[model samples]
Target chain A: METPLIRLVNVHKRFGNKTVLRGISLDIMEGKTTAIIGKSGEGKSVLLKHIIGLMQPNGGEILYREKPIKEMSREETRVFRNKMSYMFQGCALFDSLNIFENIALPLKEGTQLSPSEIKKMVGERLRQLDLEGTENQYPSQISGGMMKRVAMARALVTNPELVLFDEPTTGLDPIRKNAVHSMIASYQKELGFTALVVSHEIPDIFHIAQNIIMLDEGQIVFSGSSEEIQTCETPVVRQFLRGEAGSMFID
Target chain B: MTMHESPTQGSGILHSLGAIVLYRIQLAGHFTLFLAAGFYHIFSWPIQIRKILQQVYFIGAKSLLVIFLTALFTGMVLGLQGYYSLVSFGSEAFLGSAVALTLIRELGPVLTAIMVAARAGSAMTAEIGILRISEQVDALKTMNIHPVRYLFSPRLAAAIISIPLLASVFNVVGIIGGYLTGSKLLGVNPGVYFLRVESSILLSDVTGGLLKSLVFSIVVATVCCYQGYFTHRRKNSFGSKSVGLSTTSAVVQSSVLILITDYILTSILL
Candidate 1:
């Protein structure tokens, strides 16, 4: 009924001769968790990257709040970037920094918050992620699942309006994977931030994700809500849900 | 094994040669702009004094022991060699001038730069390369922080400030070491040696050495940081192996550039 929070139209991306995203078009609604489930190397991460301006599209356009991202001015771009955050697959925390400092970095660099205020905000995120006592510990000192939580904390530290998660729970055990999903769901609810997740967690992710977008060879074969995905008889969608699209179960 | 030449071989070879020259020029242009941006950012508002101080500690303070030892040993050797050479010429009284002139005019800055290329420069390449490989640089960009300003400019500023000071220290310690070897070990008169050292070193020589150190520092910082910053673009793909190669290339290229630059500057300064 209203304009989408972000929109991608006929986006094309290629690395060398390999066209990763072949005219991809999608819409991400506001304040909703949208999961992009696709086979490995299907340009899911590349798609997320294009949305965040990490990589520009070879063709077409990405619009944020009805404004074409590339057409925005320098100050406008800064404002746009400030309103979003990305959680890398590897949990790309600053290794040299301790957890507290890692979480505080965005707030310290991006905002004019005082030292005490930054400490308070970081402490709050740390508590939300159950990273309470690990503030002084470095990323290497923490567990893989905990590192994901720390990354989540850092991403949420800036109170962004849009957060991109790339395989947020891929390497974690099932319990931890669900935990990360639940954490994202809860954070999305509490913060009401639009989320775009490039993940393969399948049904587990579907439980938390309201909308589902399926990619097959970088082309969106299915786009609808979780219920629509389950009932859709499209061959590609069925093959993907049946774990035949070079990935695990999703239906 | 030589392959048979095709009809277009001559033209193809010329085309490739032209491409290589163009590529090299492009690279030089990129490097100039990168270094210029780093230098320009050093003057931006909210001067990153704290980060610069940290870099100075890493680049300068940590280098004290090695620079001291190298300067001392190098000076001692110069003293021994000069004394022996001048003794046969019956001019051993000029050993102070020989050691001071060599260290102040040439060896001091060259050796200090080479040492730093080994220590701080290589380490910088590896550190920044790892960050690039780990996506921390991308993270910084997404956070709206300029990676060049955050990672590179401070190191450049620190290297610019540190290398000259370290070279000066190298000269001082080297002169003292020469005194120790010539006056204390050999039979040269301490008074004559000191007097020669004071008189032989012209103001131009000292300034020239300082200038060389500054240029060498810029070369070392630019080459190494640029290598690390572009580690992902290596033909082999982005990985720890690429980072390793970038570090090695940075060290080798910086060392070669330093020696070549030294020769050019020496011709002009002399």
Candidate 2:
């Protein structure tokens, strides 16, 4: 009933001659967990990038709290950026910075928080992610799973309203993947913030998401509740769900 | 390449010369604006001091050992060469002038710049390129920090200050090396050589070389940083190879530009 927290209206993105997103339209409700499941190179990441204004759409607009993001001033865009968190596919932590500094960066740079305050908050996030006692270590010193958690911690440090997760469980072992999923679920549950997760891990997506959106060839093939997704007879949806040997997604 | 006497050849040479002049004018215009920005930051006191110190660490302290070693050996080699050449002319007393003129007018700053290009320039290009590829530069922008103000302008200011000082040091060290070679190794009277050098060389030659050093410092800093920072294809597509290409190109472009500018400035000033 309430207006969506974020919305993409007929968005189009093209790379050279190839069109990646052709009139993509989606509305992300406030305080909801929405999982975007699609095959590789289906513009799932492109959709997330548009929301953050990292890549502007060639056609149409992205709205944050019903305001057009496309026409926002540079200062407004920066302010908007700080209000959302993005976990890059590879964890994207600065190699030169230690975990403590990495987690503390947004708060230190964007906020007027004192050093002690930042330290206290970073410590809490580290403990939440079960990454305690590794503050002084560089990103290179940690395992991939831990680096993901570190990135998650940094993303959460700013207390963003919207968090974008790009394939959070792709590289993790099953146990670690489950661990990441649970932490993500818990964080969203407790914070009551909107999350837009892009992933191909169908089981994990179904387990964590209340809502599901399926992307194919840069267009939304299906959008519904998780239960609706499970029962949908759409060929693409069925193929993705079954993890079939050969499907329309094959080529 | 034989020097062919043809009207078309003359036109081609004129065209290339015209293109080079135009490029140099553009470079000078951009360089002037860069220098003006640096000059503005100079009055900010502590912030400027902090920036200057950081750059000094990068451009001066890090470059000391290479500049010194290069200068010393280059001086020694020049000394040996000059002594033998002077002996053939029966003007062995002119050995000091020969070494001094070579080091002051050409080799010292040019050699230092080449060394900096190979060492600092490549390193800077690779580091910035990696940052660019990794989206760290994007991250900085997202935080509303200007990459130029935060990362590059400081290095440019530091290079301006450090390169000229290093060039002076190189000239001194090289002259010392030449003196040692002349007196101890080549059996030339050091007094005659010093006298000839002091009488022949003027303040203008030293000034001209120092001027070149200042210009070369800017060339090295701007070309390297610009190449890395401006490299844009798309996200994730850029990697180490782009950085490597930019690094090599920066060095080659900066070196060739320095040589050409050196000739033009020398002709005008001297």
Candidate 3:
């Protein structure tokens, strides 16, 4: 299938005794938006982490562009990392650095860009994210939504081929959530980069995601187009789509 | 199972002791590996000179006033006490030797390290622990940055380079404090006071103190950084309470290790 941009083959991960991801296999297409939807604490984040080689799976393999991540040489891994970025849930901006420096850090460290060039690129990204005048402020001084947008700015500053979002709209209000959704949608359309987002925000994320993967109890119960997800009849898929706490004492 | 039906108190105590020993061994191994990695990264390519300078400012330049004040008061007190004790034996001329020796040999390095452990060391732990909790360290890894090299090697290099310098400053100020009290306030002959200090202080004493300060700096930086780096691996929730606990543990562990290492170095050097 056009040699998926990223693929996970029966990935398994466990922390001590608790298995967070159990044999999850999936493929993410190039230049498409895929949303992984699951209940809280159901391994959505863990699955995302495996894709970027952040956390190695206990078993199975993760492949990027048909190459196993585990077998990449040091130089190859570095190139792989530079080509992708993961936007943390909390923004994870360096507290000691201002927003401008934070966004400029990857470009400064990874590329041979000069100071003026780095500044210009950071300024452009900030403006694109509607964070124009907040360059001089620290992460602590910004609101939650603004912090997320700034983080997105930082993530896209390098113009990566892939971006992983970990719960991009967890604690925001509806307005902020929609803002984030629209921002991601617009950026993906313009940039045409593959986006893999892990979230439990149903219809909001579904609006932007071309494909939906539902994870439950460390397993991918369903993976299909957004329209198929809406009509899927599997019990867990139906319950998750409807946002219902299924009957507890059902026979 | 009722409390009374649980294992005997003796077994529980043994288990607790065993756990403590195991935990300490694990910590020691972790610290050794961390230090080895730090040393390795020191020689690796892409040395970040700017970060090292910033850390030097944080760990050294910013600590000047407190170190100065501490050295001054300690030396003054030593001079006052030494003069009084020597006067009873009609050997008050030895007061300068006593103050200079005490300041240069022991108090300078030990007290400076203690102060730094409380100040910069704790701050480093807290900062890194917060970074771990907020996943900034993880973000660094994803960006192909070695967290140890980017976050810690600079601090280690800065501490090693700054502690000796700070200790030297402490020694100088302390000697001045001692001179002010012994020769001026105590009515001693200034010539004898200065002469005794010159004759009594040996190269070994100064070098020994510098050596101790160097060792203490490594201990403090390594222990504090190890604590912070592992804070995220803790089983508890990654929150403010965990960070606070890690900070306290880093300071206490590093401070205690400093004193212990000081004693060992003294026993060996002296």
Which numbered prediction scores highest in DockQ against the true structure? 1
State model 1's lDDT. 0.93
At residue A18, what lDDT does model 2 achieve?
Answer: 95
Residue A76's lDDT in candidate 2: 86
lDDT of 1 at A133: 98
Model 1 misplaced stretches (Cα beyond 4 Å)? A245-251, B1-7
Question: How do the residues B48-102 of candidate 1 rate in per-residue lDDT, one tens digit apiece?
Answer: 9999999999999999999999999999999899999999999999999999999
TM-score of the second chain, each candidate in turn, equals 0.96, 0.82, 0.93
lDDT of 2 at A89: 82
Docking class of 2: acceptable
Q: Interface root mean square deviation of every model, in Å?
A: 0.7, 2.3, 1.0
Cα lDDT tens digits, model 3, B1-270, are 567656677688999999999998997888899999987787677787888899999999999999999999998888899999999999999988998899888999999998998899999998999898889998888777789998789999999999999999998899888888988898989899889889999999999999999999999889888888888777765777888888898889888888899899999999
DockQ, each predicted model:
0.80, 0.33, 0.73
**Ranked candidates, highest DockQ first:** 1, 3, 2
**What is the TM-score of candidate 2?**
0.84
Q: What is the model-wide C-alpha lDDT for candidate 2?
A: 0.83
Off by over 4 Å in 3: A248-251, B1-20, B235-238
Q: Which 10 consecutive residues of model 1 chain A have the lowest summed lDDT?
A: A242-251
